[model samples]
Target: MSDDKPVHTPLEIKLKLSLERQPLPNISYYQRLVGKLIYLTITKPDIAYSVSIASQFMHSPTMEHFNLVKKILRYLKGSVGHGIIMKKNESTQIIGYCDVDWAGNYIDHKSTTGYCTFVGGNLVTWKSKKQAVVARSSAEAEY
Candidate 1:
């Protein structure tokens, strides 16, 4: 970003970088970097998946993992001005969308549910919460 150079990375590369095949390495810097990315998720929804993937290894991160996270930082640097905007003149109706994945967490065997609401054509709020009970099915997960 110093001289208008944009750092480019494909989604597959991010996935590969995040796929850990060995035990975790030092994560002090990784923890700090992931914290910054989590903060950015407030406005950068596109980075959410990547940031979340990178954060999974925060307790033990490798050099490759750390570099991939830096790639995300560079991505943010170039796309700093990009974000979602709720237009004032859009639809006035409020609607919500929700989804749940049944027992998606391998470690806890818990489900995760997510919801987002929009007023008119603008998003007003969103949440991704873990379910309290283990879901027997996808339908049950939503309930």
Candidate 2:
């Protein structure tokens, strides 16, 4: 993945992932990779959605799933400097940004949401997660 062309985004928006697919023979490797990615999310929240997408098939990952994870690896390799960086001497301002994806999941058609909290112009925390309930519209999802 070090030599692979880096993508500007963590996940391919057009790619629709589903559960009804051929399973990969090696599950341990996929599990380990996803685990590491999950840990990496602590700093690299940009990959949170990508890691969550790959984690859905942890028990029975397919080649497609593995490829999705590989894309994340390539992203990490190319953008080695991207991630959270706390700094001092900035304004003690608290700001947050949140976004929602309307029914982005192909299988469950559930919306996904992500949020980031910044303190003093530095990213302090962030998260991305699928909604628990089905949203009728993007407005409802955001609400």
Candidate 3:
């Protein structure tokens, strides 16, 4: 992917990937690539969701999954300097924001929750994770 065009987004917003898709035979390279991406997410929250989706197929990745990984690499290439920036500040106030998508995952019908916390205008933490149980309503998912 060294010569590949860079992408603005890590993963296509409309992409619907699943484990049951066509599998690529005998390739351990995908696992290694995903492992690196997982580590990259420590400082690159922009690719967190995309990496999470790609990581799910480590046990049995397909050509489609490989393509997604390439897309993420391309994104990284274009955003080599992109990352959280910390600066000196006087305020110590903490603020947080969170949101959820009800039944966002088509395969498991699970909701995904995302939250980010900030301290004095600097991002301190963030996370995105699938809910343990399927929510019956949007309100339930938010709760």
Q: What is the C-alpha lDDT of each candidate?
A: 0.71, 0.87, 0.90
Q: Using TM-score as the measure, name the better of candidate 2 and candidate 3.
A: 3
Per-residue lDDT of candidate 2, residues 4-111 (tens digit): 787777788767986777889889999998999999988888788889999988888888898899888988887789877778965999999999989888888889
Q: Residue-wise lDDT of candidate 3 within 1-119, one digit each (tens)?
A: 78888889898765788777788775688888899999989999999998988887889899989999999999999998989999899999999999998898878899989999999
Query: In candidate 1, what are the lDDT values of residues 16-117, reduced to their tens digit?
Result: 443445644566767987998899889977676567667767777777667667778777777867888867784688899988767876545678788888
lDDT of 2: 0.87
Candidate 2: regions farther than 4 A off? none
TM-score of model number 1 = 0.66
**C-alpha RMSD of each candidate structure in angstroms:** 4.2, 1.5, 1.2
Rank candidates, TM-score, best first. 3, 2, 1
Worst 10 residues of 2 by lDDT: 1-10
TM-score of each: 0.66, 0.91, 0.94
- Stretches of candidate 1 off by over 4 Å are 1-21, 62-80
